[model samples]
Target: MSARMTDAEARERMDEITRPEKPFNRFRWTITVALLVLFFGTSLTVDISPSALLALPERTLFYLGLMFLPPDLSEVGRSFNAMVQSLGMAWIGTIIGAVLSFPLAFLAATNLASKPVVFAARQILNFFRAVPEIVFLILLLPITGLTPVTVALALGISSIGTLGKLSAEVIESIDPGPVEAAAATGGGRLQRIRWAVVPQVIPEIVALWLYRFEINIRNSAVAGAVGAGGIGTLLVREIQLLRNWATAGTALAVMVIVTLIVDTISGRVRRRIIRGPQRPVDIGADTLPPDADRDAGPDLPNDPGEAGPRTFAPI
Candidate 1:
């Protein structure tokens, strides 16, 4: 009986370790009810005339039936080519954003590190985050020839701001003790960042990268509407000709399948990152393998001493 009681106590203590305390807030329920009421009232007031409302249910059913068209297997080859192009654009854009965002993220995490240069970097990140991707596509259309490059550039630019801000937030929230330890050990600015900050945030950053890839896949399709050249152009053409059923069919199929596949893959990757090492344990302590070090590279410094490295401010 005493042993069982001790075991129960141990389990209770373990549960406490895993369960975090939630900060209480009084406004959440009130805010939710207010928003719901406002939306319900606004929707009721909107004059959705009788004919349109009556047509909606029938149209929905008709489109739902179109899903059984056996998937236009004849157009498979053409659709595959277009999908490949859009995916290529997504890949190119994601790579560009990942490459650009690394150093910028270090600069943007101004709350964790309040260097004047870092503050400036944060402002630049804010500028990029504020602009919508569609707007960038328009701006890039004239400058860069209207090819996949234009779409890729627009997606990449939009992604950089989003990724930088997210990465910065992750960096800012890290425990400062590790950073202090690294500095105390005589690690240089870059080394300190490498050993302390990047080690902690790499999993979060990789998760973000995967998530951005999924987002870019969707964005690439939308970009095709502007002659960016993908399914969007096809959808636009169908809509212009009043081929509503076909347009609806293609959209529904693509949205369901593409989203499912990307979501599944990204979820798996994110889970792997969050969980501890899935494979054999590493015994090495101080030194990293040359390959690992080479792949990751040195981390960017948060501290901007006199004359920091010249970095492009995002805007």
Candidate 2:
């Protein structure tokens, strides 16, 4: 038979389970302190009386209840046209940016450019990215006489900087072995780039281009503020005229549709590119072995026998 445990013994066992000296969770403690400060600061600065906050949900419900009424489908045709125009502007801008940035992206990537040139090109890309697209829209309106074309130009210019920087990074991060192999085999710079570097990075760059198209769509929507033409101009007009109901409806619809379409399409495209079949590498019959080129007779008249029947050369 065992002796019955004392109360002190049971308490000691419970204390071991609880571990009183264990450290507090740092993340949780930090979050608690942050919330306390935020609440105190908000209380001190804002005129958010207890009554106002308590009644806030009621006020919000009133506005949402009004929105349940059917949207003014009377202007459906006009709205549809405006949306189409906005889409067209976005499409054109994305095309221009994607096409124009290819060379710049290559130039800015150290793998493709001379070391010095790439350094300078990267700085130029950084400078362009620092300026907001809206600023470009504002600057170009006066010069180009305010049109969808101006918006496209502005969006394209600003996009090139961001696209180039991202593309360069992708290019730079690729495996260097294939490129080195190509170069060591007596391939010229262009040949090495075409066969090795481009093959690895093309899928990623194309994915980036598609992603940029989605972003351009959003940028175009907001470019209308500076007379760069789009649905934003109509939305602005509605707001300025105190058509709050119409403004609210349009704003909500735009937010929902753009978010849904961009997230769905970009996600699908990214997955497809990542999982796509890679380009097959062809080992040419005429391609040189690594050391074969070094043994080739110096550029002088040599007998066919001396050159070993010219079995290998750079592909």
Candidate 3:
């Protein structure tokens, strides 16, 4: 009994010794403090004040009330027209961007191109991505004037950077097995890409293009504010020049409705594209052996002697 008690005490002590300890992470706390200080310091440098932030909600509510009161339906016709124009601009721009970026994407992909090519392609993409659509519009306005074409061109040019970058990432992530298989079959670089990479990445790339289209729509509306020929122009005219709050509110509402509808449709399509096709499971078939039928054939002459080992002459 004493030995048993000693063994139990030993086991208990072992458990205590082996148990894990949860140590306080002083380093984590130190990092958190440092980040907080940096954030506050930056906020101070930017002249961001807590008092101004606190007053924002009340001011926002007041503005909303002013905009919504007696919502004007008179501008519906013009608003709808401008909205349609914006949609057209976004569609054309996105299509153009996708077309132009498709080739650049392959060139920029590290898996497909050399370091120098990838670096140069990435720098070009970065330049376009860094410039906003509005800036593009500003620069092009002199050439294209204040037309919807200007907005479309601006949006397309800016979108190429994003689309190319994302497409390159997609290309880089494609499965190498098919590519290797193609090369094994004596395929050249282009042939390998056609037979292997394009099939695997096109669907996702297309989905990304659709997503960019949705974004471009919103951007096109904003571009219109600067007289680029969309609802935004009308919106600015009513709100800033005519001071027709009701008309401006109507235009804003129309823009929101159209944008929301496009976003919802595009989002659904993107999800479907990403999920790919669903295949039905064959539960019974899955359980069956590959040679089940052959295995079920009459037991190969239980005794080879009984069947007298049959032989056939070669044809």
Candidate 4:
């Protein structure tokens, strides 16, 4: 058969093997084309034409030059102080969000609360998320008087929705075994939550709070630009109000350096929190080479001593 086959037949077989089963799926092609149409159609509606895109790089370069070519170091001390203030704002905001969200998360969790309560809690969280931090800041301005504290309050309120939603998810995904065992032992709702739920969720929840802190750090700057007193305010004032490019550059540099340091430290802590203590590995006789014990080495014995099931205990 090999010698009898024509070259055309072999080529045809090779082509068939390489070809896809459905090379031109009408549904997939239609969907892709529809998405493309929607993207371009919507982009056009928002006035994002080709001409604007073509000039974007030049416009960006103009600002980049203003920020970094020769930053003024005269205001380094003041910029550093403002950067510290932003950090404080972020820290306080995170604490507020963590405290407020910790309880609401339980309420929103289906396993932890009745359906009605969960639904209501979710609705409340949704309301918080739907409103932007800027809006909250604006509303609170009259009361808080355009201070960094107001920025912190806005950030905290905005964070509640996100933190609560995530914490609820973590709660829902916890081990049911512990919860069931607690209930079996006549553990009341509070007892189950305290023993089973809190233990399992605390680490992840803390990690979430840390991550939120990192986000809030960035957000604090933006909030400051909107009338609050922080590095962001300094940056904006220099760039737009005072037209002091050198001063703006100094503030921008300080903000970047401080933010990077904070993010690095926070990320390390979050990773360590998530990856808790690991179990130590042990050697077993079954896997050792035969005659190893007799030859100043170890051998796998037929009757290996039994060790009870391993359990993790905190140091």
lDDT for position 144 in model 3: 83
Judged by whole-model lDDT over C-alpha atoms, candidate 3 comes out at: 0.81
Candidate 2 RMSD to the correct structure: 9.5
Summarize candidate 2's per-residue lDDT along 1-315 as a digit string, tens digits. Answer: 248778888798787896468677999999999999999998889876888889999987776655435665565456556666777777788778888888788889976799899988888888778998888888888898778888888888888888888888878877787778777766698878777777777777777777787777778766657645567766666555655665456554664576567758886876566555344434352465566545653432111111011111101
Q: What count of clashes does model 2 give?
A: 0
Model number with the top TM-score: 4
**What do the candidate models score in CA lDDT, each in turn?**
0.73, 0.71, 0.81, 0.82
Cα displacement (Å) at residue 123, model 4: 1.1
Candidate 1 residue lDDT tens string, 102-153 = 8899988865566987878878888888987789899989899778888888
Instruction: Write one digit per residue (lDDT tens) for candidate 4, span 123-222.
Output: 9999988988888889888998888999999889999999999889888878787788678767799988987788777877888999999889888876
Residue pairs whose backbone atoms clash in candidate 2: none
Name the runs in model 4 displaced over 4 angstroms.
6-9, 12-31, 48-54, 278-315
- State the weakest 10-residue window (summed lDDT) of model 3: 301-310
Tens digits of lDDT, candidate 3, 1-315: 364657779888787786577798999989999999999898888967888899999987876777788787888898989999989999999998999899999999999999999999999999989998888888999998988998999899999999999989888977788788778767799978886888778777888899899989888876746877888788878778888877778889999998999899988787666664355423355454788647855432111011111121111
Backbone clash tally for model 3?
0
- The better-scoring model by TM-score among 2 and 4 is 4
Model 2 accuracy (lDDT, Cα): 0.71
What candidate 3 gets wrong by more than 4 Å, as runs, is: 1-39, 42-58, 279-315
